[model samples]
Target chain A: MVIINGEEQNAAGLTVAEVLARGDYNAARVAVEKNGLLVPKREFGGAVVSDGDVLEIVAFFGGG
Target chain B: MIPAKEEMLAALKERIGGDLLEKFQSSAAAVCGLGGLGSNIAVSLARAGVGRLFLYDFDDVDVTNLNRQQYKASQIGMSKADALRENLLEIAPYTEIISQKVKITEDNALPLLKDADVICEAFDKAESKAMLCNLVLEKLPEKYLVAASGLSGLGTGNSILTRRVSERFYICGDGESDVDTCGTLFAPRVCLCASHQALAALRILAGLYDV
Candidate 1:
């Protein structure tokens, strides 16, 4: 029941880490935002994804 | 004879039109880092007749930076902020340019960014970029922040993209092209991303992009 990056997923009790793992996203390179707030990297393990929650995960690329 | 202010802006005004040009001339822009992206952002703003520019960089121009950065061989050994200021002046002599030869950290980011209507983040490090983005979103919540990333290697030019991350944060460059993957940055892609940052800043300044 979570919307991740515009796609709906049945993530009722998944932690940020679990959701990321399910999607095969590299946690090290991606920054996560949950409900318009940035989730600190350390909190991904504890941050949970509930029904109707929205998440946007962004990745960093190096350049000038 | 010192021409009137209107006379100085007539040519640019004719091109960009009076209204948008006026907005540009009245806006102030802050560029953090005078490297490849920062230098080009500064110069692009200058040519677009941005009213004032505040630039920060503690590094000196190195010969290696000439590959993708906006600098000349003669500029090597010069401070980046000063060297970039010189280049900006060549394009828009009347544009007010402020150069700071100090590294911008969380402590000084606010004061340096306060006067600017829009902010351009052009640091080379991902950590630095994240720091500035966090600082602006947290402290200067009202300011618009434009940043660049993923512009490395000679990838397909079409791969580079500009994305709006939030209400006031815009990111330019492909989300995937990292230096670790490409191993080197080519000039064309870097400049394309820089140009995107510059255009984003201008759009925010001109009220074309809502902050």
Candidate 2:
């Protein structure tokens, strides 16, 4: 199992795109980092999530 | 020797003294984007005697900012941070002002925010504001950040609201207005938003909220 946003998930073999699709959020609005390395938006479909990986995702909205 | 909290509290009581003043005297704040909203917020904080202020702005004062900004026409062409510092000093000569005339980016964000007890995000651009907020939230989750949005025009008074979006994040101003529709801001609305931002900062510094 892997953690997506601190929740334990069974989708360890899923790609970043799959995870975003499951969450119903656009990949462009978020910046994802896997273990401190930024996963570019273009590579979301190709980048795969593995077990014991720490992921941090940030979403942007209207702000000052 | 460091004065007792009670003694400091008493001195502050002569003015804004109380639990809020006590908390404010010990707090350090960083304000980014010294435009209309940011300038007003800095002035309010200085008047309230916030212990230290870290002011950041890369732009020079322009003719358009005079309508709502706390700055004057004479300040045109001067660095916004410098002008704000001068104005704030007139209100609270004892308070410390750390002025930085530079654009905030990932590389310098930590350096500018290292000692800030609270960060006030007052940048105008959506992309820059979002980037800074995301960086601060991701890298410094424990730090409190108050941001503003939707303060673009003169509209219904009820449009303004100060909301706590998360434990460490808060936002103020109307969410419906934008720069496109609002044209330029008037004094009343900008001041209202600035007051809300100041109140939020005061509350956060006094530990009124868990965040």
Point to the candidate with the largest TM-score.
1
Provide the clash count, candidate 1.
0
Give the C-alpha miss distance for residue B39 in model 1, angstroms.
0.8
Give DockQ for candidates 1 onward, in order: 0.55, 0.15
TM-score of each: 0.89, 0.75
Clashing pairs in model 2?
B12-B17, B13-B17
lDDT of 2 at B10: 64
Best-performing candidate as measured by DockQ = 1
Instruction: Grade the docking of candidate 2.
Output: incorrect
lDDT string, candidate 1, B1-211, tens digits: 6456677799888899999888998899999988888988888999899999999999999999999888999999999988988887776889999998999998988999999999999988777777787677667878988988799888898988788776787888987777876789888888999999999999888777753
Lowest summed lDDT window (length 10), candidate 2 chain B: B1-10
How many clashing pairs does model 2 include? 2
